[model samples]
Target: MSLAVVTLKKGEGRLLKSGGMWIFDNEIASVMGSFVNGDIVLVHDFDGYPLGRGFINTNSKIVVRLLSRDENTMIDEEFFEKRVWDAWEYRKKVTDTSSCRVIFGEADFIPGFVVDKFSDVLVVQSLALGIDRYKEMLVELLKKVLAEDGIQIRGVYERSDVKVRKQEGMEPYKGFIGEEFSTLVEIVENGVKYQVDVKDGQKTGFFLDQKYNRLAIQKLCKNARVLDCFTHTGSFALNAGYAGAKEVTGVDASQLAVDQATANAALNGLSDTVKFICEDVFDLLPALEEKGEKYDVVILDPPAFTKSRSSIKNAVKGYREINLRAMKLVKDGGFLATCSCSHFMDYELFTQTIGQAAKNVHKRLRQVEYRTQAPDHPILWSADESYYLKFYIFQVCSDR
Candidate 1:
């Protein structure tokens, strides 16, 4: 039996008992001995009262991602599969299609792992050292479980190419489990079809998290001129065009991405209604404003603003600058669809930044429909960071 101890300070163990997972560096009183990354540990109160069992990694900021409260049982594939099945049942009740995040890290009681399903294929990304240790087991179980549900395991590609993985002393690795699938895969979301790039595209090859939020913008883009900044593959712009927008212009820094967006528009048979421009979104937005261009709806979904606390100040600056410019580009009574995926920057902080941007630009926000990750990406109360995606759709009331 694996035995170790993680001592929590006097009252800090309260959350632990209350089902709050994640033992931060400060929460631990001591290891009481040496422990390797992914070693199973028994958590205890300051007085050594038995708390629960979880995996530990001294190298990561989050020291532990607890698995169970039972000590008699062992943590293995069954333990993980049980939790995953429960999550799967919940998803089946909520979603009809196979497209969604099947397992959400802490929410599924298996921290450090996330699995997103797109039709028959599965995309997995591991962020924690402990989770990395069980990567094989989890993937095996996930593929098996998915197969039973009529989901063919097209590929098991790793998008661990993220920045956080480097901090854990891991390198970037990505490819198909056997052989790569066609980078171009057709995906249907809310009755709208999109061409996705899985091998070399963004996270999971598509931002499925914004599935519903983009649909919301579609509801408002009727007969409107729309601008989609940072339009990676033109999710927002495509939705606007499908929703009967008078016209939609997509902008991004990647020429290849712009080409994909153009192809996607044609795929949707809306090429005449949409166009793509390859350029920096910041510079392009300013030029559009200078050209006396005013849009009825503007979408600003930039990449993570802050990767760490140290970069938060600059992130705030970047978010505010772009949001302020987006506000100006919107005509009176227009809509602004904006978002931030930086977990370090809280929703309140981003809200304040956007509110300040509105004030500086003399635009009044008429309404705010704050949204988070899609139903597929469950937010385990134990881990707030897992709930990173946020959307703020508001009416840009102007003096015009």
Candidate 2:
């Protein structure tokens, strides 16, 4: 069958040309040949120069999500197997494959598909129509590749119930991909145990992107009083306890999260040192200050304040407010670890926000180190979306 062709207008596709994977609808000049959404299409520049093949979806703003830059490459099962293998191999080299992000969507050259391996269980999120069609095949291929290394995958869970699926002309869905087993799976990271609920927890149960970032905070926590905000599952707070923190108080808005975090603390035998509170960090921060509370180390890992560019202005205000409060609660010459997971926040803006917060609180920030997501979640340079996490560890000193 003849392939559909999508030709870009002259001087368009600057992002694709610069190594990005998405081709927006606004960039295309015309489409020729018969094809339905999610079908593979050949893309060409204005001069008829072959750009490559990608999955097309007229229903979405991202008209084409490039699968390969090589026009000859087929988007077949064998091709997908190779892609999965490459992603797995890369993770094995950079991180522990037993619990790490296997396929990071566009960063792994497989757009809109993310597979995270948590021990013998795999959690898959298929967010695009083109990739969703091949989800089953991809899971099978992943299981097979892992089996080759004697890693037996007990079950696969699909967490594609995100609103992004709706934009791709697909319904949101969630459940076991194969035979249903215990949704609660245990995995150890940085010597701390966690029960990852693949079925109902937020965004694939646990935040695997901060694997090393959690470890980074542990070093500064030894024998210190620590405050962890937005303590999802108590990863950082538990790490602080494991690092010999004298006291650790974790705060989160969700009761479910607090309960899970408390269980995780007990599982690791750190309950005595680490305790979780179900309260809004915004309210708790000021309340703690009013109570004359202060800590040696304050860690903030709040959720993404803004998912879209339009809300960035409001998001910055939220970020600044929390950072300002956290800084105020830190003891003089204490450390503050803050991060923004929103891609729209960007590095420069996040840093500037923190600076503004320090200035407002009459504190001088002495930078210790700046970090991003763990290596498993590789940041593709050209794809701005791939680099979402920005973590900073600072020593806050009273300016007075």
**Tens-place lDDT digits, model 1, residues 1-400:** 4587888988786566777787788888888766777788888889977778888887777787787887656887888888877888888887645578888888778877888877767778898887888888888888787778877777667777787776666776776665667656687887777777777787878888888888888889999999999999988899999999999999999998898899989889999999999999878878878898899999998999787899999999999999999999999889999999889888899999999999998899977588987877777676667778879999999755
Kindly report which residue stretches of model 2 are placed more than 4 angstroms away from their true locations once superposed.
Answer: none
lDDT of 2 by residue, 139-207 (tens): 999999999999999999999889998899989999889898999999999999999999999999999
Clashing pairs in 2: none
Which candidate achieves the best lDDT against the true structure? Answer: 2
**Cα RMSD to the true fold for all candidates:** 2.0, 0.8
Q: For candidate 2, what is the TM-score?
A: 0.99
For each candidate in turn, the TM-score is 0.93, 0.99
State in Å the error of residue 257, model 2.
0.4
Estimate the lDDT of model 1. Answer: 0.83
Off by over 4 Å in 1: 13-18, 32-35, 178-183
